[model samples]
Target: MSKNLVEVRGLKKYFPLGDGNILKAVDDVSFTIREGETFGLVGESGCGKTTVGRTITRLYTATDGQILFDGKDVTHLNKKDSKALAKDMQMIFQDPYASLDPRMTVEMIISEGMKIHKMYSEEETRNRVYELLELVGLNKEHATRYPHEFSGGQRQRVGIARALAVNPRFIVCDEPISALDVSVQAQVVNLLKKLQKEKHLSYLFIAHDLSLVKYLSDRIGVMYMGSLVEVTEAEELYKNPLHPYTRALLSAIPVADPKEENERHRIVLSGEPSNPINTLAECKFYSRCPHKAECCKAGLPALREVKKGHFLACSNADALYVDNQGFL
Candidate 1:
């Protein structure tokens, strides 16, 4: 079995909205990413996908639970340890334009991490920056220009170079390609895959696009409200989705064959998601799940293995099935 590079156990992040109200962003989520593998996370907007990434990278202090990086608990590291930990973990933000500083040139942006970590001499750092520029499909000439001078895809490349400067083992990619043009997204994703193979890196790739996630992930986890409803191998997830929410999500994907597309039936979820503030001890997706039972409202369902290597959190998984007519 491959060793897990990162392990998140019962992770929770709650933001205080003031007026004695707390917004439950990530609640009791757990998963493991193996070394050199990509673990994809998918959900609708405001479903706490980004929050999970931020909390795991220690950008936001987790409200509860444990985060273990290479067998070391880092949920609350000290200043010295946190600084040292930076060399092994990094993040690629969703918005390239907003993440990069307009005033700084690409060279400066990429070398800042090296300078902070005191990795190499000035001459060596400059040479490394040039190498990284070339590695990400940009020339050394582009390094002298500011972020505004590059296109959206080029800016994202620069972001990738910056993350690679310190030679990280794991990265949290928070929708890194969502802001780019449809044509450019594939190029960026291909570059990331190449880099992962070359560097033996692990990634927690968060995105709302299910097709893209399926293409890049070794395993996929589906989130609803603030909790994970299903997790399994990428191919297994598409072939056999047990949770009602997972079935609904997969039903929305468009097929290429005209005949199949016309015959497909979409599962329309009724009612808005329940509020996340001070939520009760009940299933978060109970209101919207098509196969919801009275027992679902009694308490929260624990994630359990429903089949070999496939985990699900639902009280009525046994009764749910997909037939020729559709989900029933």
Candidate 2:
């Protein structure tokens, strides 16, 4: 079996509002991404998916919990060690245009990480930048152009190249394709898949798009109100989702066939997602879950394996599963 490349245990990140309140962006989330596997994280906007990615990548420090990257504790690494760790893990930000420095050329942007890490000589770095540009579907000639000169998709390609320039083993892709046009989204996803296969890279793929997440992920994790409520293999998640949130999310995906689309019942979740500030010890999804019971409000349910490899955090998961029958 492939070893876990990243292990996040009880990871929590909270921001103080200074009025005796805290925004719990990520609260007690735990999961593992195996070497060379894509672990998809899906949820609605403001659900802490991006915060999870950023915290794992060390862009934001964890308020609590452990982050083990390739067996090393990254939650409190020294500056030198942290700088060294950068070569092993990199992030592809959600917004390509905002992530890239507008003043810098593509070549410079791609080479910056390598220069910081001292991966190669000046001559080799230039060659590596050219190679990276081509690797991400951009040509060597395009490397000299500024970010403003390219379209959104092309700029994202540049962003991908910059992340790859460091030759990292793991990447946190923070909704990398969300901002691109629909026509270009698939192309970027394909490129990412191709690169993953060729480079043997592990990805923490975060997005709100269920269809895309299902397509590219080896395993899928459903997050709601800053907590992971369900996690299982990609196929298992679609085939037998136990959590109400997961089922609701899957139901929202539009079927391409008209007949199937018309026949399917959409599970529209009621109420906005629960507030994450100083959350109570109840199911984070309690307000939105149709299967809510008195037991659900007793306390926060611990994530437990209901079946082999399928984990759920609902108090009445088994009951919900039985009740759903053919629906889920």
Candidate 3:
């Protein structure tokens, strides 16, 4: 059997804005999640990171594509089949406050999924909820309280517990640490890493935090607008980024050490994001690329491999590395 827990191919999601206009939110994206690894998806806001997670969960159907889960093509399952598919896959949403139900207590929040799936009896449900609450660093007492009673970080732990309640094999961590304090962010990340190890869970971890991605991801994929421009082993991506957009994003990560910060310079990118409607077939970063060329504005470049595992989507991936004088 293939080692991949999830496989996505030619995924496309588009929205019509009326009058012959369309917004290509997620266009022609493809990736894979191995059985127990975190496949990090990083991009700026409005770049369809959230849309990818939602599309995978079938919250929004793809305009065209394939979603393979555990070797099955569950891409277009109907409501009945989809509900069954959800048993093995779950998602932890980005916004803890907004994602939680205001009227429900924490116990109801976590147990509702188990009840819908008919996974437990009423007595067993409460016990499962208690176990999950403790697993996510929350106590049994917190289960009786409303979402408003906890801090942002606590509410997110509750969300994590809810996702785990179903005992899913695959989980989409949609920026689960983004809305928390810096200290708490690491805690949440560590919790995820621990949970993955203990449960043998596979994750499609989406985030814009470069530092966190470097820490938690086995492989990293960089997205610009709605397209993946580069994907490589996490350390290799930070060390030898191939795409200009990836270079720019990596350069933007702040260094904690002053000496290291002084040694390496940051790349400064200009120009606004391209129109998602994709009126032109050019490379999306061409408008702001430091090493722009006339050829880049004509057609979209297909992803190419410079090495065994590194994939880059740029016509000028190599050209930007060296100076004009040809010195490395």
Candidate 4:
């Protein structure tokens, strides 16, 4: 196995909800991304997939935990250290339209990171900026244009170009294609994969798209209510997801084969998700778990590998119960 480029241990983040209540946005999340590989984080909305990405990139400081980059601790870096760290990691936000500064031209936007880091002279920065545009499938002429002048796909490509300006080793891709049309999503994803192979960059790709994750990722991590419920290779996750939440999530993905789509059953989760602000030291899915037992309510399950390289939180993978009888 390749050495881990980034390893997170017991990562936690919380937001105050007033009156002694706290929103546990991210709780005790842990994972590792090997160098030159993409690690996909998949889950439903508000499950802290985005938070995990942001925290990894240090956009949001952790309340408690350790984030080690290449065996060096990075939880609390001073200004200089943070700036130095920025060169090694970058982030591509969910909304392309919102991520860019409207006031700046495409050239300015792409070179902004280089300017802050004092990486290049004026001419060198300008030359490199245009080079990035072409590398991302745009033209030198487009560099003079504004962000609003481009289509959604084009904008995303620009966002990617900007992210690459600093020559980062890791990128926190926070649902980079969620805002684009179906036709454009594949193009963006393919471009990312191509770049990864060429640049040998590692990624913490955060999204809810299981099919897409399986398509692009080497390994997959499943999160539920701010906690990672399962981690395994991409094929293993699709074939034998262990946790109840992961199995249910995998079951929900629509299969392409008409026969399979028609015959396959969808796992419909009952009850509501736990509140992020509540005291949820126990299992967050306890309220909706079909196979919930006495021990499950007492405490949340810890992640343990049932098979080699296939880690899961739920103790009983073979005994998974589902209430979606007629639906499946």
lDDT of each: 0.91, 0.90, 0.87, 0.88
Q: Provide the clashing-pair count of each candidate structure.
A: 0, 0, 0, 1
Error of 1 at 187 (Å): 0.3
Lowest-sum lDDT 10-residue window in model 1? 319-328
Which tens-of-lDDT digit does each residue in 1-328 have in candidate 1? Answer: 7899999999999999978899999989999999999999999888899999999989999999999999999999999999999899999999999999999999999999999999999999999999999999999999899999989999999999999999999999999999999899999999999999999999999999898999999999999878998999999888877788878788877877899998989898897778888577768887787877878887668789877788988876665552232333
lDDT of 2 by residue, 1-328 (tens): 9999999999999999999899999989999999999999999999999999999889999999999998988898899999988898999988988999999998889999999888899999999988898898989899789999999999999999989998899999999999999999999999999999999999999999998999999999999878899999999998888888888888988988999999988999988887788568767787777988989988668789888898888888666574456434
For residues 157-216, write the lDDT of model 4, one tens digit per residue: 999999999999999999999999999998999899999999999999888999898888
Residue clash pairs of candidate 3: none
- Which has the higher TM-score value, candidate number 2 or candidate number 3? 2
User: Cα miss at 135, model 2 (Å)?
Assistant: 0.8
Q: What is the C-alpha RMSD of each candidate to the true structure, in Å?
A: 2.2, 1.5, 2.2, 3.1
Off by over 4 Å in 4: 318-328
TM-scores for every candidate against the unseen true structure? 0.96, 0.97, 0.95, 0.95
Better of 1 and 4 by TM-score: 1
